[model samples]
Target: MEEVRVKLPFNLAAGETEYRSGVWQGLVLKWQKEHLLLELPAEADSISSAVYGGGMGRLKRAVNQFVSRDYECSNPVRDMEAKLVEWGYPLEGCAGLMTAVPLEHAAVAEEDTGSAGIFCCVTAAAGNAARAGSQRSVLAAYRPGTINIMLAIDGWLSPSAMVNAVMTATEAKAAALADLGISDAENGLPATGTTTDAVVLAVSGSRRYAAEHVYAGTATDLGGAIGRLVYSTVTASLRSVKAAEAERK
Candidate 1:
């Protein structure tokens, strides 16, 4: 049940448009047997320079401040799953641990108003299933007021299974800020990257049954798309497990 963290780098040396086109790489978490592991890719690379103005400006600063020289990051879904598979770990659902921190202003009065980081984290957990396979459960975690809306959904529903549902929920929240005519990438935070845009991070956990398995998930798409795939995979696996269990009964 131990957690192992590994820093991953891209094969920029292998490709021509490595840095310019962006490559996938990141930090990984694995268990004792090394069978299951989770990957956490920094959100710094998820910036869409075109869609969100000032995204690149924020991205550059974030990379320099939070990421290492070798860090080749790209969103955090597929990369996370890839890291697990590469390590030979089975897929699981979300872990149900989501939190958001608000942003703040450093120059304001000392006692008047501090900032909340304004962040959200989703956790997915996977474990052995009935047919000697693995199953996952996903949970969405967000900030107050808005977070409850996401949690109001069925408790047993995996965040992966309801990808659109989750994104719709998040976009709805972001829309409010957008309506305020605020740029998603540069609000007013003192943080390294674009202070305006909100940061949403999702994490998946893989647990190895024994101590001899290898770690494999990789962070590929940091966009909302991968979230759909993760959910689809888990939902399919769960169905297969249920069918097998029924046969055994």
Candidate 2:
């Protein structure tokens, strides 16, 4: 069973330059059964370009500190600033939404593989786009693409499923981009969507933050939510950018 009863959409902001520039930054804590786990975006698989890897690295370290230090940061704002600065992409304010997810079981689309848990958040930035498998030279210097999903699930997931999750999320994002005609002028891919878009995820042993925290639906529900949320949020961000550009024009 999944844990539907949750206290989520909580806020998590840290850094000298508030992590509140764009979307809301949140830190969701799901207290349930079993163990402890920490997840961050996969480098090279996400928006973690050579230039941005340091940020990811710092994020990982921060998450660890937040966790090992009892899963709470004394100063999250500084933590966020450190993470971003390490990646040389520090901004004035950044934000994210933290929420509890229902992933106690494998998604419904496929048969029951195993049980799982989820907590995820996303931030959108479609400033640039690049093709998959393209060389680093193609990426413009200083310009960062949009979209970064931070997903952390509890319990073990087959390695294949884990990889599939990233691709699936990317595909859904691409579909949303296509629907909105958000592609590049050169190759027609999403302007903000790059082959190297970032999807950070982590899986670990289950740990109960509270008592009796099981979700109601299967992991499929969670998957759908990720796609739906990403689509709407990213599209909205894209619109915001377009509107601003038009206004400037």
Candidate 2 vs. true structure, TM-score: 0.46
Stretches of model 2 off by over 4 angstroms after superposition? 1-117, 131-137, 140-143, 188-192, 207-222, 243-249
> Scored by CA lDDT, what does every candidate get?
0.23, 0.38
| Per-residue accuracy of model 1 over 1-249 as CA lDDT, tens digit each | 112111111222443211110112343322212111223343232222111121222121111011121334343344435544554434432211111111100000001001101112121111211111122232242111111111111011123433433454344333323333323222232111111123222322221111211211122122232222223322332333345457889
RMSD of each: 23.2, 13.0
The regions of model 1 sitting more than 4 angstroms off are 1-23, 29-36, 41-165, 168-200, 203-224
Worst 10 residues of 2 by lDDT: 102-111
The prediction achieving the highest TM-score against the true structure is: 2
> What is the Å distance of residue 23 in model 2 from its true position?
18
